[model samples]
Target: MTNQLVPTSGSPERGIIVPVPHQRPEHFDAETQERLNRVDDAAFEAIAEGRPENTVTAYGQDWAAWEKFCAETSVPVLGVTPGTLVWFVEWLWEQPGKKAGTYTAPSTIARRVTGVTVSARVDHKVKLEEGVARPARARLTQLKNELAKTRETRGRGKAPALKIPHLQLISAALPDNLRGIRDRALMLIHFSIAGREHELAWLRNRHITRTDEGLVVDVAVSKNHPRIVGIPYGTRLATCPVRNWDAWKTAVEELTGEPVDPDEFAFRRIHAKGKSLMAGGITPEAVGDVITRCGEIAGLDIRLTGHSPRRGFATEAVKKGKEREAKRQGGWSKTSRAFEEYVEEAGIFEENALHGIGL
Candidate 1:
């Protein structure tokens, strides 16, 4: 005889039965779902939404750190509370060593916090359909409030201006060689152009155009916008022009040994004894190396880099700007916000202010 509730032989209910929760396949709640969704979306958007490459790389690093933290703590991202975020910030603060300490700058911390918050929000929202409830809006508010406080504490203080004597001394002591000549030219151009490292690296021979007025450099890519800079004939070099410009031109011509097309790179690799030595073009890191080597040769214990040229140019321009024409030749764009930074970094404004009073 077969029981009514229990199946007997050949009945459909003869096998063992298991139960499954339809809403929660993995047993994750709404908060977890939202956090997961938010992280995924943020990463995808950062890459796909035309964000700058540097920004994307930075966000990727922040996301990786957050993921590691969550995995170690066994905490679902959506369930991360303000308290947890505070701990993360504190962890960042205690990251150890100068590199890590510097990494905890206010801007860096803010980005990391933003990454985590976005990830949590997305994951929570996505899981809501599975019966997971959205987190209260107040939690987000609290997280932001905490982040603001941390930012206030982490804001960077003004650093002292890089010294001019240090730069002048270093420039004077650079070793005499083809590499040195190239470095010196790069230094001069960097200062004269107030160019970023990447811009300097990408400079081509065709970019330098000779107009009736003077030598004009057409900056295709710059921090603010594409612009043209002209250097008049009267500009004097502190060092010998033969070593600075003439030698550079000769070296470049020798390397190419032929008429170079306009699109070709102005700088090329130099060869010695039939083997290529150093290639031309400057990288951002190379700029720093040049400064360091110059410092070592000069026996000066100061931080210097390609940026020093820019600072030196601005400082000297503001000092020599008793005449309006001199100030105009400094290549400063009044319209750009970066002008203020360069001015401040060079301390040119302060120098000019003091000079105005004949102090």
Candidate 2:
């Protein structure tokens, strides 16, 4: 049947049809509309508040993941509940790939979960202020509860600490030639200084100063604080610089095959096959790989990494400090967590026992 255009009750019957007024789409409910606007506002506010790019990127990725999950599950944003969040966490946990598609370490997962919970709580607060009825609780508390449940479902895994012998073995395994010497020196410096890999990588030749008394390393940047570390005249390492600075000077010169410039890296790149040196500094990954190779050479059946030297240094220094002025030479900050770790490793009573026993 052909459709006829009938006149409305308010219009004259001249067969003149009037256009219908446009209505907003029904897909966006009042709550959903509010949430969509809030999301846009929050994003703008986040940027305006000067949030770091990395942090903003992480949040964007996380929220995008949430939206994807919701769309797949046919869940509405305004209908999100704590139970929905729990399910989302489970979905994330069960995802295929390393660490269940999260690509995050355990500590990283913990941190990210905390962030998600915080975002949810913030959204919940916005809803509540808009007359949505719900009791408010801290996001941390919610995260802790969810984490406990998740852990209960998925059994905890153990992570092993790096071993010192493994590190020594790695060092021993490197070709005992020029590269070997450089690797050994690098390892020794890493352990002796207990420095971060980046700090070591960025270390310049001028940072190391030799005087009539001793050698001192001026650490321009550090985790806790910037400070100078000195090797006094009497120590074994000190003699190379204090008693005869030329020994270190000559060793460095021989390694580099040129007069070492003050602006050059303390450890310059040397070609494995030849004596030719490169101007650029070594990366942390290269340093770690070299250490791993050293472990293999030493015939040690354990894993090792660049960080081993720093941990080993802290362990050894704590042990050596028991009888002598233990705290003085390490150059550790009074408030540093390393101090606590060192003390824990070097038991106070065990240190006092030698003093108690008469020779």
Candidate 3:
């Protein structure tokens, strides 16, 4: 029989139709609706909260190390047991050093363990109950406490502070070449700006602006803080950052056969033989190496790192009786504990008020 809707009054002879209730289709086109259905909102949010590139790279390395150790010991990769963590902590503590006189520092061990713990908890989704977690925590805590006690007698081997005299020596010792000019500019700018290694590495020519006063650098991002600050031309032309910067820019322009673009990296690698400049900017590691090599040339018997310039700026400011200004200029937070240490180092012998008492 042909289907027909019946009237609600049920008069069979009259063929009045009653419409059946049906859900309406969505208004979106087929392709657009399908795309919307395919989107994983949770995944998008996870991606949005992702860490920095360097941090991700380090996590990859740390996870790899943990996996390798677990594989060798025939332990569960995804379900890491409390006993496995204890053994890993032991291995971290007693791991053989790459050099004869060195072993893994306590801080390094702590970082590795932290990385592994995060990987287990987040990546593997390992959830431990109180019974396992309590003992695991106890073991790790005991190990860390023991390590700290053993290291109590040792000194913190920080990078040696570079002063103006040291800078002058290092600058003078550089060979008179393209590399020399570049290094000179890098050193002077690093010392003057008091910027961290990554900030220096990421600098573009566009970030610098020249005014009647001097050159100002806009640090787009720094360690924990970012801002704009001016670094003025020094009275001592020999070690002036602005002069060195101009000389470097001129040299680069001559080599490239064009004016340097604003977006171009401020610093680039030089060929070891000093024949030509490399295409891209130098790494933070290379920046640290430059300071170390310069220190060797200047006959500084202490180890130097990338932090030397930033620390040097603070120390110099302290010595010049500009502690407050130095703290502000160096981008240190108001609650920073490091201010006292730099101040003490600056005034230990020369600027101390107690020296007049002559005890």
Candidate 4:
């Protein structure tokens, strides 16, 4: 009546297996059990094994897109050829993204290729021989070159770099209420540390320690790794993260009618009608909502997300001529090639040659 299979375990080289959610029941003859086991294993492996939920979701989306494209084009999804990959890249280049009539970014196309490659080899057991992979690589190289040219002729994507004045305006514009206090605290803490959305949402009172200088926040888990970051006391009361946190924390304690539990989530949803708190931690999406709402109130018409604060921190720091400080604060690893992109994006205008001109 039951056929259960667990991932083989031994060495770290063997990947961790997370159970697939909402697994469907299959009624089959006992004779076919062995044959279907491998198939089921392959299906599960197609998913991101041992990966974070967000990563799994992204990979799933990439795979789904690839699958859809293959079906539509009458191309073999499994054992996909280099020619097919080249075609896929071209197809990606032609597709519209968020904006009307605008093509997708080259970076996005590159990730889709990576996702398809991994899924084909690891999950589908398709052989990606050097002969096949080489041409595909060459085609991708051509695609990159073409995209670079297009970027030079047109411009980069639509992520607007937020500034300090925008932050000040948004903060000042917020209504004087419990939600406002929470949002102000969230923004200050998020911007100061230059941490990711999940990092801010997952924070706990236990992870924060009072210090002589200001506050030491222990980011227990982040996109990179865990680290203890310092938030220095602000000379200005208007923009002080420590002060905002104290006010928010006091309000939270009062609403809960108990001392704030160190282990509990620092940020939670405040009920709209009353002063009651939600029972769970806030999501990363909620962080984006806060940014969007604040941005609207500040009279900006740009699409903002949770990444705004981190990106804003980098851009603002570079504008202030503190490139090294920005990298360190944002937890951007020195070894990562993506560091260059961050620098380029942040410092492109600030460090331009025209700055030195008398005109």
Candidate 5:
């Protein structure tokens, strides 16, 4: 028999006819609909901001590189088969670096395939299969090993980790003035917290609390996540984070002739003449600038970045047998490879096999 359309309420003509699977539209109140719309906006925003901006931008560039390859090679952009993926990587490995004779760095090569896979799904709405992931990673590893043995390390690599001695030198080199006080507090607090640049940049006066021991800081452990960290009193008053912070706060109050509002920035830019404070807070990049200035003043050889304090904290903590505390304080996830690297650096000379044979 031929199939027939079924009518609602068993009426042949009154109700509309429907196919095999019938459906109906539903309505919600205006307030409920508005809330649903907000939920959608928030969900997407969260996904977008979930990763750090640099990672997102790097992946976007990686995807663009894949697109460029596909265009030149006449491969289908969406048709990312295992063979195509492997071919794309092989093609990437042959590309030139910024230098005349240098090839693409292994780190860049490592991220390309993963970036392409992510871009395929997130940008093009295609879910490439997982069939080639293992092979791709294996081949990438082999290429990295070969390149490591053959190539000279030429790039501006990881920033040197600052130590306590460097911190002391930086402190002494800063002038005996308002800006100097602010820089001192900033770097000391940064080290104390093992802070990310954005974390220090995000702080407000209210986030810091004065405790009997030291200051308790409320910080975002991740995007929109809050955690309280304790910064204890230091061995001496000169290099103490808490005392330095108090001095900075007092100086700012003295300059402005008004008490700092609870929501005001913990760190602010100073005037060039060193006479006044700027209206807005210093940025994340400014954190690095301050550290670099300090490094120059202290006459240190290694390049310093905002991340130096965090690196120092992790390395020193592991060196002192505070591995668990280091991870927790540094906000390093349990499986964080970067955190493990710091631990490795701290232990490279520990229980050395060649110690007994030393001169």
Candidate 6:
């Protein structure tokens, strides 16, 4: 008999229809079923642990976007074909994006295809044929090549590379206030740890380990990998991320007359004109906003994004001939084209062999 979906709760909304993976077909006995049930339980736990939270969110959003695409164009949600994937990529080119007058990015379009693929295999339990996806992948590759040749987006309103000097300038201009204290700490720790804004937002006092030399922060990178990032003591206490972090915590305790909870988020929403705190953690968007706000306060004319720190960290590492270490620290897989861009940015001019030979 085929393995059956068993309900754990009475209502459908309340944990009904749980999955049982790899249940044996010949396990008709009650004892065998119970043994398979234990195995299935472990399998479910592994499934949950396998994917990182950020990836989970992105994949969810990607699937939702696919559904939206299907709704708009009257395509079947699971009826994925090479033609349909190509159509989705073409449709994305017409949709509005964050960039003014631009459609979806090449990178985003590629990721959306991955979302549909995952949704088909996992949620719908249908493995897409290799033949069906290969053509679409080829088409996407061609499109990227075409765009590179055309240079349609050559430095037009593109956010500049956020280097160490830019951050130092922003740090120097931060106000000596509660909100500023939090912002400064946030930006510095974010860059030092080379984490995504979401990761930074999720950080709590519990992740911090203060030592005589510096601070050790346990950061959760993408794919749920945990890493220890060190922030050594700075020559100047005023600009030190560790000291600033401690000061912010101390200031919060003094203001509320209570020690910060280990489970509490490191960054929280500020109220009363940025002088007081609100409940719950600061959002991922707010983490990015702090960086942009700091830049604006420092009179920077360049645009900055939440992802700048991660890119900056990678580039800086590449500059120091530590590209592999940067890739590992930034949670980038060996085959990530996005991470390759950072490596290129760091070496494009610095590594040019014609630099001294030409002049």
Order of quality (TM-score): 6, 3, 4, 5, 1, 2
Query: Using Cα atoms with residue i matched to residue i, what is each candidate's TM-score against the true structure?
Result: 0.55, 0.51, 0.74, 0.71, 0.70, 0.79
For candidate 3, the C-alpha RMSD (Å) to the true structure equals 10.4
Give the best candidate by TM-score.
Answer: 6
Model 6 lDDT tens row, 1-359: 33555545566545434445664567568887788767766765676467776777888988888899999999998888889988887777667887577667777878888877876766565547777667667787877788889877412234456677887888889887898888888887887787888889888888887898888888854444678777887667656788888888888898889999888888878896977899988878788888888888988878777877777877888899987777666667788887788888889889898898968
lDDT (CA) for every model shown? 0.56, 0.56, 0.75, 0.75, 0.80, 0.78
The TM-score obtained by model 2 is 0.51
Error of 2 at 149 (Å): 11
Runs in model 5 with CA error above 4 Å? Answer: 1-46, 49-120, 131-140, 221-226, 271-274, 348-350, 353-358
Model 4 TM? 0.71
The digit string of per-residue lDDT tens for model 2 on 1-359 reads 23456666685665654555454646678988889777867875664356433344556566666677788888775455655555565555544434453432333334444445445545333332231112122333454477678864232232112344444445445554556666665665665566656556767779878776566877664544556777556344421224333443566687657888988787667777645566687876677766666666676665557666665556656666642333444456566675677567656655565785676
What does the lDDT come to for candidate 1?
A: 0.56
lDDT score of model 6? 0.78
lDDT of 5 by residue, 113-135 (tens): 87887667655656466665567
Where is model 2 more than 4 Å wrong at Cα? 1-103, 109-176, 232-252, 255-257, 272-274, 322-335, 348-359
Candidate 4: which stretches are off by over 4 Å?
Answer: 1-50, 121-127, 130-141, 144-158, 270-276, 301-304, 319-321, 335-358
Residue 294 CA displacement from its true place in model 3, Å: 1.0
Checking candidate 4 for backbone clashes, the offending pairs are: none
Badly placed stretches (over 4 Å) of model 3 are: 1-50, 72-75, 79-89, 96-100, 117-156, 350-354, 357-359
lDDT of each residue in 55-166, candidate 4, tens digit only: 5555677788788888889887784778888788777777777656566777677778777877776667675766664565677678778767885421135445556777
- Greater TM-score among 2 and 4 belongs to 4
Best by lDDT: 5
Sort all candidates by lDDT, best to worst: 5, 6, 3, 4, 2, 1
TM-score pick, better of 2 and 3: 3
Clashing pairs in 3: none
